[model samples]
Every structure is written in C-alpha cells, then in structure tokens.
Target: MKESNYSSSMTGLELAREYYFQVGRPMLEAQFPEYLPKIAAGLVGDGSECLGFDDEISRDHDFGPSFCLWLTKDDYDAVGEEMQHAYASLPGEFLGFPARNTSARGDGRVGVLEIRQFYGRYIGAEQPPKSLKRWLYLPEDKLAAVTAGAVFEDSLGEFSRIRAALAEYYPEDVRIKKIAARAAGMAQSGQYNYGRCMCRGDTVAASLALNEFVRQAMSMLYLLNRRYAPYYKWMFRGLRDLPILPEVPPLLLRLVRENPLRAENAWKAEKIRNPYLNQADERVELIERICVGVIEELKRQSLTSRNDDFLEAHTYELMERIRDPELHMCHVLEG
Candidate 1:
C-alpha cells in the first residue's frame, strides 16, 4: 500500500503523540480497558527528540514513532509482559516513517517501563531528591532528561507527580551553591588562566581554559534562568533559548573562535608586533565583559552584592547565601 502523506516536517515528539493516540491508545482501550487509566504514556528521555531539537540528521538512528507506556509496579507485575507483547505487535510503520532501528543499548528507551525503574534509571531515584546534598549532587543533564518532553496522560498521577516535583527545578540553596561553583570556575579558567596560558605560548592550554569557561558560563546561565542545561551535546543549542544572557552566546562563540592557537606562526616568530597577541588581548577583554554581565545578573538576583569584576570574589559571597548549613560548608566548588 502507498504511504500516507503527512508532512515530513513532523517532529519525533509530534509523531510519537500521534502514534500513541492513533495506535497505542486504541489498542489499550480494546484489550485492556481496566489498565487504560493506569498507564502514563509519553515520549521522553535520552533523545534530542524529547527536547524537541531533532532534525533530519537525527532520523539516522533511534528515530521513529515510539512512545513510553509507564505502569505502576503492581500493574506491571500483573500485565506488563503481556502489554509489552501487545505493544510490539502494533504496526511497525506509522504515518510516513519506518520502524525504530533501536541499538543494543536503546531497548529501554520506549515500550512498557515500570514507573520507579524508569525514573530510577534517569534520576538515580524514583522520587525527587529530598536532601539538599542529594539535590546538589544529581547531574543537571540527567535532571533535564527526566523532565524533558511531555506526559500525554498520567491519570495514575504517580509518574507525573514525581516528574512535576523534579520539573520545579533545583532548590534555591542548591542553585546558589551551583552558581557559586560556576562563578569560581569562570574566574579561575577564563579571567585568571586564559591570559596566562596565552602569555606562556601554551595555546592548547589556553583553548582548554576557554572551553572550561564556556561550559561553566553556559551552565550558570541555565541555573540563573532556573532551567537545567542538557547534555553537553546540546548545551549551546539549549542556551539560545534562555531568557538571561541572550547576548552572551555571541561573545562565547568569539572566545572559542578567536583563539591565539589559530595564529601560531606569529607566536613562533616571536615578533614584537604579533597580531596574535592582539587577538589574545581582545579575548581577555571579552572575558571581562562576559564576567561583568554575569556579575550584574548576580547582583540583580540578590545572589551577590559585591561589585568586583573578578567572579571569584563574588563566589564567596554567593556561597554564603546558601541557607543550608551542610551545603554552605561544603567546598565552594563542591556544587
């Protein structure tokens, strides 16, 4: 039979939603009406598609119409295996797309997932971390993954409830702690080390320092906006959407692109009028400008009151703002 004509523009999430409603949902209603309300279905976890960042290139693998059906442990024990079988029996081809070509490690991305097991896999716990220390330690990208994408229907409320709690973002103390760490990292890497590395003619080290600065700065922006930065692969892609530091991305791009390493011959020649030195100077100034913007935001958010241009100075002040005694006492860089 000829394929249907749905636009190729349909994203993975959209395709999953449609596939669930048109195929999965009806299958559940017909064969397991008693279990319908207990299932929480959605496309989430471990995919660019979940974050709505998938494109044509993303279709090369693990890219097709598939959604997760989360069931409570009790319900899963009773019918999980049978439900999985039924789900597997559904149409392989949906809309205009081929069946998912799941890799060896991609088995659990979709299909019947036990609620606690699914959450545990992504978050290290079935429920949101209750302790400030726990919250401080959980990986930000993992948190982003657990909460990304949509929960189509969660009448059981167990899965959605935990997800909603996690989606609220980090506790204020945890955020402050993390922000303080980023501030310290930005200072040590970009403000203090980038120039020094350039002076020593260690262009590779300078580039590494600048890279660390960009990563920390991007993470700080996400913390400031109360969003969890995704995995490193998508960090910059995610940054463009942040409400804070909208201008910082361009500066960061220039910091990486305008490296002294790119002009190595000038440095090797040891010329008095090295254009590469000028480029290095320009990067230092850019680093300060970025730091000033971050400091201003820190002051505006009441994270720090210090007026210092060096971010390390503000790091101490921000760390002191953490109300939790245990978290406050941990290394300022611990977060």
Candidate 2:
C-alpha cells in the first residue's frame, strides 16, 4: 500500500471513527445485515489512540485506520471467524493513510473481537469484578483502559453496559481505601523521608523518594476527583484535565525538575549547611503545600476531619470513614 501526501489535524480516534463509517460500516451492512444490530463498533483498548493521546509519532507502528467490532459470545461463536475475514477485506487505506502496521502484540487490537475476551485481556475478567477485594486489587490503569475511547454504537448493549459500570469509578469504600493508601505513601515518601535523604547526601535515594511522593500525590488527586489515572505515560495529560487539585501538577513538575543539591554539594553530608540546602528546603515546603491542598479537599469531601499538615494523620481519618468492617480493619496502605 502507498501512503498519500494527505495531512489533517485528525486524531487516531477520529480517523478510526471515520474509517468505520466510510468503509467498515458499509461492508458490515452489505455482508451481514442480519447481525448489524447485534454488533458493537468503536476504537477501544491498548493504544495511545484509545486514550486520545496519540500523535504523529504514534503513526509509525500499530496505527492507522482501524476500529474494533465486538460481538456477544453467541454471535462470535457463530460468525467470529467469518466476520474477521470480511473485516480484513476492507480497504487497506482510508483518507490517504496506509493500513495499520499491527505489531505482534497488536493483532487483536483491531478487527472482530468477542466482548468477554476483549475485556478479559484488560481487567482479567469477563465482566467487571463484583467483590470489593477484586475491585481493590485490580490495577487502576487497566480499569482506565476498560472505560477509555468512544463506543460509536452498541445496539446489543452488553459491551456498553460493562463500560458504564466500570466508568462509574470505584465504589465509595474502595475509593476511600485507595485514598488512604496514597495519603500514607505521600506522608512516608515526601513529608517524612525526602528531607532526610537530602540531609544524608543520598541524592539517588532522595530523587527516588521525590518520585514516589509525586506518584502517590498524583494518584491521590485522581481519587479525590473520583477519576482513574491513566497509565503513567499519559498521567500528566490526564492530570491536566482533573477538576480537583489543578494547582498540584505545576508543583509536582517543579519537584521533579528542580534539583536542590548542586553537584559540589551532592554526596557531601558535611556540606549540608551550604546555600544549596535552601533549595532542598524549598522543595520540602512545596511538598507541604501540596499536602495542605489535598487535606483541604479531603475535608470538603468529608473524608477526613484532621487539622494536621502531616498526611499520615489524615490517612487514618480517611480509613475510619470506610463502612465495610473487613476493609476498615485492613492496613491503611493495603489498597
């Protein structure tokens, strides 16, 4: 297939949608009209495209005009293979773009897929996990993927139903537990250990501690906003759109980018009292500011009533709000 010189501001998700309507839809309507109403078509699962974060760099591989066609188990068992063949016969190029260069891991990303199999690959279940333990243990990024992308049509409703249930975000008890974990993590890594590592001249350990603090802080922001953070690569992009703690991102960025210790002062514990020490002190103060912002949100949400700058204190208070006996008794960091 030859690539055209065509260029547009279209995102991968938009390209997939247009491809489905212009080519995939017509073929399905002509060849399998009887099953049209039962089929679900959209661009979903396992791609920067699915998350609406794809760009020119995303097109070099596992990209281009493609969308998923999901079918119920019964419909799949009957026509899954046949439908895939029909899908393969669709135009290799659409809107002047070449066909998707599907890598080995991307084979199932496009074309006909069974609904259960499609979800199972992401969340490790045919349906959303029902038990609290299952919900707590499932990875947040996987849950994000399960609910990402646009479902253009789902006449049968099975696929959309699962997506909707997962999209409701975590149950209240589970969310509280997760928030408690993040609070404890931020307290331990940022508030407690960051300055200690800097004082001890362990810059590597100090950097790692700051990274942990940032990770925990980001997760806490998402939980506070009642949204799932996407995979780490797209986290900042996702974070930018979150309604709560909008100021926290810039502080987190400064925490990661600004190195408090100068090269001459690094790994020199005896020189801790130098001018560079003030930079480290500023980062610690910044971390405290973030903690304060989170604490304010926690109070507003009635998740905690603590009046402390230390996040570990609030962690216990948040856990106390958990109504489930089993969950409440579990370790604050279990989630």
Candidate 3:
C-alpha cells in the first residue's frame, strides 16, 4: 500500500489511452467483436488524470492503467456482465505499469459503464441538460469533468457527438448572468468588505474576504474564456491555460500566500516597511490590478460598458446587455 515513486513521461490519461489501444481494444476485438460498434471507450471523469494534469506524485493511489467502455442501456442489458469480466481479465500491468486494483461497485473509476449513468454521476442527468435552470445549476467543475479527457475510440459516434455539443460555450444570456453574478461577488468580497474588515482589525475576516475574492475572480476568468472551471484542486493549473487572464493565477497564488494585514504592521514600523510587508502590499496592489484586467476583457467582449474599478457596476452593465428579458429581470447578481 506504499506510494510509488516511478515517474513516467506520459500522463495518466495517456497511459490509459495507450493501454486501451494496445491491449483492451484487441482483447475486446477477439472476445466480443460484434459489440465494438455499440460501445464508447475513453478515460474521462473524476481524476487529475482525466484533465491531463497528473504528475509523478499523482501515481500514489487510484492511479494506474485503465479506461472506460461506455454502453447504451440496450447494449448493457445484453452483455454487461460478460464485458465487465472481460475488462477485468486484461493484464494486471501494461507497458511496465501496474494493473488496476478492483474497487467496490459504484466506486471504480474505470471499466464498463452505462452511458447515461456515466453522465448522470457528473451532470445530475443522464441526458444533456435542456433547460436554462438545469444548465445554470450544474457546477462548472462537474461540467468540466464530463467534458474533460480524450475519447480514444467511439465507433458508434453517440458519445462523442453528445460530448461535442456539451463542450460548446453557454448561451449569451447564461454567460452574461454568470459573469455578472461572479463580478458582483468579487466586488462584495474584495473591493468593499476586504478594506472594511482590515480597518476593523479583523484579520481572520479579512483573510476570508481575500479567499472569496480569489474564488470569484477565478470563476470570472473561466467565464470570460468561455471554459468550464475544473474542480478546485486543479483550478490554478487549469487557470494557467486560459487564453485570457493567464497571468492571474500566479497573482492569485501570491494573494493566497501573503497576509494583507501585514501591510498595516509595516506602516506602523516608523513608516518604514520591512521587505515582507512590502511583498504583502504588492499583493494587495495586484488584486486591484487584476480587477482592471478583468474589466478590460469584459468591455472588449461587449458584455459591459462601465468605466470604473467597481466590479458591481460592470456587473450591472453586463446584466443590462443580456437579450433575454426574463433573465434580465432576475436579481442582477443571480446566477
């Protein structure tokens, strides 16, 4: 049960895809050739591997060679058990990688899966969400999971086609609503309450405010890029890939690492700040700078027309631009 130190050049997703191609596919072809066209195979869902962010350290637990074989309900009823047994019978190791340890039912990351159930586990629905509320309610991270990872093979085209449509950006109204909500959140947490909390000597509250600001700011960045934010564990890594606001992650890291209250302590030291406090002040400055950058992008995208550092105003402006009458009438900060 000890962790492995072996670091392969390929990512876990790559390893899984290789395993499927070199071994799983051939085994299936020999044993269940007729079933090939009815199944979709890939490495997707619930892991850093699925997002292609796995590193050497990621090979600790629940990390190894594996891929999913997704079948429609009709197909599952016919050959589900046989397919599972066949999948389990593959080599315990592949290309120098160790074999997967069997997980309890409903807990395994790989193997045969019903296509609807596979999607339902992430998106709360077996089918693609068609309603505005359903789309709005699903977490961005969950959406990211459903869409992340590569589908190595899909002879039936059912899975990939649905995935392609889901991968598209939200409707204009949905994007505007989300952007405005996140913008308002940033304004409340960073612009308004952060300073007030600092003035009250409530460093704890100030830290929470900083966290909220960072959280909302990150979401806003993903919305601007029209990309779903991955789970928080890989958010900064995901943020680095955004075409817009790519530099914000490092700035966010600094904010999270330094204490904002340190700036006041530095001012107290005969008005001569120490290097540590200087760094803290610089982080605070970067917060405002990030807001400006986001504002510029919002205006560039024609989502807003406001000209101020206040994010709430930009939120309102964006809300006004929403063409959907019903969405525009809801609370300006409503998601």
Candidate 4:
C-alpha cells in the first residue's frame, strides 16, 4: 500500500473551511448549539481556495483560519460577539493546523467572517438580491465566484438565496449591454481591426486582435448562458469546463493562440486578406451557435418557458428570466 502525502500547499481558504467542518462545526454543535440554526458556514468565490487553485505557495500573511458565516443583521448583532468569542475559543490547533488571526493579514490563515462582509467585498453589497438594481450592481465574476465553491454548513440557508438570486442569471439589458459591448469589440478586433493591424505589419497588434476576439467571444457566450465570465486570466481554463460548448472551446483557443503570420496565410487561403480576420468572423458565428445550444440546453433542463420566445429572442428572454426577482433561483440544468 502506498502512503499518500498531505497536500501541504493547500489553500488557506479551504484549510480554514475544512478546519471548521471537521473541528469547528462539531465543537460549536457541542458547546454553542444555539447558534447553529441561525448561521451558515462555507466557502465560495475567487479566493484561490474557492477555485481549488490555492497551494502551499498561497500561504502568506493573508492566509488564516477562515470560513464564512451568514446571518441577517438582527441575528448577527444579537449573537455576533458571543459567536466570535466562541469561535475564538475553539482549539487553536486542529489536525496539526494552527489558527490565524482575522485582523489584517497574519502568518496563519484569516479566520472566520460574516457572509455579508464576504459577499459585500466581492460585489459591494451583502445578502442575496431581490431587485433589478441589486442584480444589475453585481459584478459578473463575483456572482459566479460566490456560487463556485462548496458549502460545508448552511444552517441558516442564507447562502442559497444569494446563490438563487444569481441563479436566475443575468438581466435582459445586462445581456444586451455585454453582448453589444463584446460584439462591437469583436467587430472592431476580429471583423475590422485584426485585418488592418496585420496589413500594417504590426504582428504584435495582430496578436492583440486575436486576444480581443477571444475575449469578446467568451463574454458573448457567458452572457448567453446567463453566467458571469470568471477572471480574464482564467477565462479560457474556466470556459473549457462549460458543457454547452466543450467541443469548440479547444478550437477557439487554437485560433486565438495561432501564429499571426501563419494565421495570415490561412486567411489568404480564405481569400479574406486577414487570417485572423476570418477566424474572428467564424467566432461570431460560433458565438451565435453556442448561444442557441445553451438555450436548447435550458429547454432540455426545463429551466425556461416554452413560450418565452427562445428562437426569436433567446438572449434577451434568458436575461429577462434572470432579471425577474420572483424567479431569481433556478435548479442546475440536467443533461
């Protein structure tokens, strides 16, 4: 039998979370049972931990014994201090792990935090949204981030509503705004800009055009799916995980990463003067197809209405559905 090594470089976010799940939760249940029903504990968002991208290298002063606790303002104020004290009292060491102070960044992990503060930092507000204004205010990645990681304990069920509010997805104008933005960018870079850049012998600029095309295409897809695009750096890595366009993600990546000079040759073969130019146009078509595929996936999952104008006005309708406060939450689409 082989002995497995502990993932030493694991995320402080996850470590703080697992600590609570194994040690903190049980300890709290035994000593402070009353608080259990009023709050929730879990992990989600872009913190290296949430995405499972954290490592031993991630353990800096900022890393500490951290987990999220959710409570309404009243409940939070009522028991906040007591809960904080109790949390502090929990054995400082667990499974050979040491707890870190939450204030500023310390040598250890950033300890527990309230859900409101956690979400607010990412999106500038706390609690799930029930209005268009709140919905519109949410940054795309933050919504996706909060919903990305796992929930270890959700006693109060507050996280679900936040997740649910975002679950319905992006709003109508939001989609158009992002799509129009990305489309205009796509037209500028792939449709119009890349060609001109290549013609000028600015291969560097040509490459930038490819990058822009890839970005706009991705924003277009995420908008269509009513999901937020993750951080720009991780967009492609994350985009590959989307089931709707798995087949073409690699292809898109290939086009984006292709040599600008050689790509120019392919475009001449395409008789389009711009190798990357034709590639960009193809992306526009691909974006529409991917959009339609996602809409069909929604239908398959029963996530949308049949009479909702899917074919004629798919993106807008999806955005509209997501915008409706009454319909903020949605179940994951079934295969």
How do all the candidates rank in terms of TM-score, highest first?
A: 1, 2, 3, 4
- Lowest summed lDDT window (length 10), candidate 2: 271-280
Candidate 3's displacement at residue 236, Å, is 0.7
| Each prediction's whole-model lDDT (CA) | 0.87, 0.86, 0.80, 0.58
Clash numbers, per candidate? 0, 0, 1, 11
Superpose all Cα atoms of candidate 2 onto the true structure and report the RMSD in Å to 1 decimal: 2.8
lDDT of 4 by residue, 1-335 (tens): 11123525445555767777877788768866887887677766555566655555454434455665666677667777777777667676544455443335331122345656767767666466655555655676777787776777676777676776666676564554444445455556665666667656577887787687777667666765566777776667677556665665766766665555664454455555434345434443443454355445556645445543123343334444454443333221100
Number of the predicted model whose lDDT against the real structure is largest: 1
Over 147-180, each residue of candidate 1 has an lDDT whose tens digit, in order, gives 9988899998999999999999999999999999
Tens digits of per-residue lDDT, candidate 3, 1-335, equal 23344425767887888889988999889998999987899988888888888876666667788899999989988998899999988887776677664444425578998887888787866357787666777888988988999898898988887788779867778888899999899988887777666656577887898889998999999999999999987887888788897778788888788756566575444343433223235555777878888999988898777789878888767877878777778786677
**What shift in Å separates residue 171 of candidate 4 from its native position after superposition?**
3.2
- Candidate 4 wrongly placed segments (more than 4 Å): 1-17, 53-65, 85-110, 126-137, 261-335
In model 1, where do residues sit more than 4 Å from their true spots? 1-5, 262-280
User: Candidate 2 versus the native: TM-score?
Assistant: 0.93
| TM-score versus the correct structure, for each prediction | 0.94, 0.93, 0.91, 0.67
Error of 2 at 47 (Å): 1.0
Greater TM-score among 1 and 4 belongs to 1
